[model samples]
Target chain A: MSEITPEEHTQDTRPAKHSGERYFGWTSHPKAGLYTFIFVGVLAVGLALADFFVHRHEYIHLAEFKIFYALFGFAAFGGVVLSGWPLRKLLGRPENYYEPEEETDNG
Target chain B: MGDTLMSLLSHTNPGFIVILAGMLAYVIRGEIPRAVVTIGGPLLGLAALVLHSALSEPLATLNMMDMTFVLYQVERVSIVFGLAFLIAATVNSIFALHNKDPLQDSMALIYAGAAIAATFAGDLITVFVFWELTAVSSVFLILKSGTPEAYKASMRYLGIQILSGVLLLMGATFIMGEYGTLEFDAFISEGEGLSLQDDPGAIFLFVALGIKAAFPLLHNWLQDSYSKATHTGAVVLSAFTTKLAVYALWRFFPGEDSLIWIGAIMTVFPVFFAVIENDLRKVLAYSLNNQVGFMVCAIGIGTPLALNGAAAHAFAHIIYKGLLFMSMGAVMYRVGTTKATELGGLYRTMPFTAIFCIIGAASISAFPLFSGFVAKSLTMSAVGYEHMTIIWMMLLFASAGVLEHSGIKIPFFAFFAHDSGKRPKEAPFNMLLAMGIASFFCIWIGFPFLGGTEFLYGLLPYRDEAMVYLEQSLWTTDHVLTQMQLLVFAALAFIVLNRVKLYPPEKRGVVLDFDWVYRRPLYHALVWTGAVWSKAGPAMTGAALRLSRRVYNRIEATFSPQGELSRGPLSAGMAIWTSIVLAIVMVLALIVGPH
Candidate 1:
């Protein structure tokens, strides 16, 4: 095999340039994430505020509290996301973990 | 002649027509003809279902082995499921039109047909036959992936599925023994199913359905096989199997007390695994498990509204879940893999697919004016009515979890996350058409005043309860607002977590699940045992032979005539003693034998 030059190797390892037509180019803008966060934050605050004005009837007693669903939703989602750190450590394995032996046997 | 044909068509089990189409598709080499047969089959099946003259009566029956098998029977619940399945089949055929593999095409229709057959089956034996057929036929979808891993996964899937079928047969045997009939109508009366406490067979049936339903510990086969199936195969596979199990459970074991907690756990635990999962398809599989959990829990509640929720949710879920799979399948079609780490910036090229994927995501997240909201409302309300506060809380948490994995992660990572800078082509026209149809249903069945919701509600087992919910509780201001709060806040949480850099990055690896118990430890234990036995087995056998030979020699040495016994002559005292012993033995034998 021919030795790959330093420049060629670097190029090979670098992410490829996107060559297709850009359908949602705005998504790639630097401020897109900031915009999305702001939009969702506003929506969440609006919904929580609306809960106070609306005479909300609920079957469960605890849900009658202001923003209970909102708090629960936030905590549940955050808890699940944060738990991923430890869960990955506990359960994650190499991509080839299950297949190495089968490959060897087949070979 | 036309009247006769109509009568015959109405009498036909729609599944048989689809199976015939599958058989026809196999030999027809031309693409157009094969597509015609494949797509036309489900259409015909739908027609057959619609033309049936009466409900809850056997349209077709077969007598064999001194028993009658109701091959084609339609209940309201069956109609809803069967309708959804037929719709799924048609859409799936369209989605797979670009694929040229006859084996996959034929097997898919057969699998779909078997599921439909089992759905409409009025007897347990009939259900068992089609149940095994579904397992046998659908394994080809996974094998079609043409990878060693896929092959192995397919084998595991088949083994587990066949085990389920075997358990079902055992339960049927027990039912026959106890009830003297396998007919569902004989045991399950109006508004009630077989009680697990009263019936010994119900437990076996429960476990069997549990395995198929992907109940928590028994769930790995779904993720294992589904993620390995061919792209089109996954879309087809998503539509039928678990939903069929849900239907069976609703038919046989509604009001099961254990199912509520089982379903609650199912909904919760997959959230963690899915959060860390890198394979996008497997994430969808976990999401599927969570969604099915809602149906299972509702079935446990067994209220009219709850049952309606289960049926409506199954119908909507089949469409939306299949749509999601189709979207991912489209991604897989162009990108060759659905690993989150490798997929991004895809929306730049695949805008239509991205839009469809978003629709599927929104539908699954139970966003207002989507199918999930309408379908899930009944279940949530039913649990609330029953005063199951803990169960309701768990379901609420799981709903947020669903948003994290399926609603946001799926679309966000695949289409809009950090660009991997890889550009891929848009999906084929057929795939887009299928997704478009599914997306339309998601909106149609969800949007108010569209008549889709009304039509779906009309098909519920308890139509009055469903209609009442639709009119009063479903669209009430508080209900919609609370649901919106849950989803919007969950999404806000996602954004906040991402901003804080707490969201886990997609990594290239496998997440161990319950399958690890079998795939790693149990597998290694068997291997270790085999290796030990290979070495120690012969040595132990040789030792055993040596000891036995020594014992035989000792006995021979004492008994041999020429060596010891013949070396000495008999004495008079020995002869007298022998005679006395003989006389005593004769006396004992005479007394005992006569008595």
Candidate 2:
């Protein structure tokens, strides 16, 4: 069976370029909270990097526990992504897994 | 003699609740019996608990032919679990008032009573008897759905559950053979957590309890049956079975090192499944697995602090999870679907129920002001203090995952996701009320200033830290902000992913897990085995029978009356008398040996 391509995931073909909800009771913020989030994200990532370098005794090497976690993280992320494929159908049930049929249960 | 009779009348056992429930099932037309059993049976249990606990003397031991076992033990942990169970049974009964199915109500009560009875059991043998009672009573709730799948799933569920019970008995029997006593306290060996070295029967019992607790790969029966049970059935099932296993673990396998890793894995594996799962109930089943994982990990930690954490988490989870189930049950009652894809915009109508669902979500997510926040922090701190960095990180990861699946996805998808345009009516008043009470627990337990939080901490394994933890660090601004940061970022990820069309939408097919091995392939394997058995096993036996008959016919012709063994009175009488004497000897030996 054919799978939906990632290219088709985005729906960018709108007549108007719409802005999100109004910010600070003035104008719509097309990029509101975007930079703030990015800044926080970068700082967090940088901190993680700094910790890895700073704590070389703990970080330069893969701890036994980290191996399990890295493995799990990859496995879980892959499971989610691959689930979108027809592979999911192998286990998926119809929405009516337990529904009583109208005619059968009806008096 | 009069006092003895009075004691016996009020005491709890496997027989009274089930037989009474069976009678109640026979009499009540619909909701009344369920209401009575759900609400009234617990009060009966509390009275029984009082009777047993207050008996002044130690619980009377009973010796039945071969096995010697205590009728009850009123220890502190057992008391807490029993009280929690009593409360759960009552709450469950209330939550189930909207259910019109009597069989569900009856079976639920029997199930609850079995759990309580098992908790009070002071010996392995007594626990085993009531343990299987739990299995037998619960299968009906799954079967009560009256669908073919429910029938099939419940049968598989019953088979696995009964197998676990038999395993427990096998372990108990072995323990008795080794120790010459059936009391639970006398189990001589404790495995090194998951190791096979420390005890023979302990590992078997651990695996059996692990099966009930939904540990890792052995946990398929939960998702298999919980996903298929009736709306009320799911709630009833959630409260006891797994928690009982956690209790068993605490009692028997505390300090076994293997549990730590196993519990960590248990906590993590279900999040991905919960995130992608389409069935709302199944998602909760995964979430339930995740919650149980926390308890299992704590039990594995095996410190008093950790054990208390496990007990506390089980207590808090039963209510909030039931509340979650109640809210979902309301939705299912009104609209007849628990699929996330088919549900949305329900808050506008079922506002009260929706609010309850949100409360459940928040409590489970360990939001700073919920029951989960308090109970869960103990385990996290325990692991941290022990310097198990990996476990600590895994738990933190799981906390974020919990936020994604339970805290956000549950309420977000079911109540506030893209509108499905189905304007179902508000859930029944009783259902909403059940949700309301559950929500109250989530709040009451979370507020540290409130004595409820302090009281829970007081009951911890490390009571010395109870006051200290509450005052100093439990609600530190830095800690709260860090937790919020993690949870909020995870929520942000889910939102961004959803908005960008990257979040996995609820799909129309089953996600294969360990259950797929059993439900689809093994189920079909068993069917194939049945076909093979019908075709091959009996036919082979039949052919052998025919060949034996032919040989016997030839011999009979030579003997003129019968086969060689039956030929003469001299031989026959001797054989018969010998067999008779042997049977008598065995019977007399058993009768004369014990008691």
Supply fnat for every model shown: 0.79, 0.10
lDDT of 1 by residue, B1-595 (tens): 9999889989988999898888888899999999999999999999999998888888889999999999999999999999999999999999999999899999999999999999988999999999999999999999999999999999999999999999999999999999899988898854588878866688889889999999999999999999999999999999999999999999987888888898888888999999999999999999999999999999988889989999999999999999999999999999999999999878878889999999999999999899999999999999999989999999999999999999999999999888877678889999999999999999999999999999999999999999989998999999999999999988988988888888999999999999999988898898789889999999999999999999988888766764455355564466678999999999999989955
lDDT of each: 0.92, 0.73
User: Model 2 segments beyond 4 Å from truth?
Assistant: A1-107, B1-37, B47-57, B60-63, B188-198, B465-468, B526-595
Off by over 4 Å in 1: A1-23, A105-107, B541-595
Interface RMSD of 1: 2.0
Expressed as tens digits, the lDDT of each residue in A31-65 for candidate 1 is: 98899999988989999999989998788987989
Give lDDT tens digits, candidate 2, residues B419-516: 67766777777777677777777898888677788777765545676567678767875456445555555555554565467766777656678866
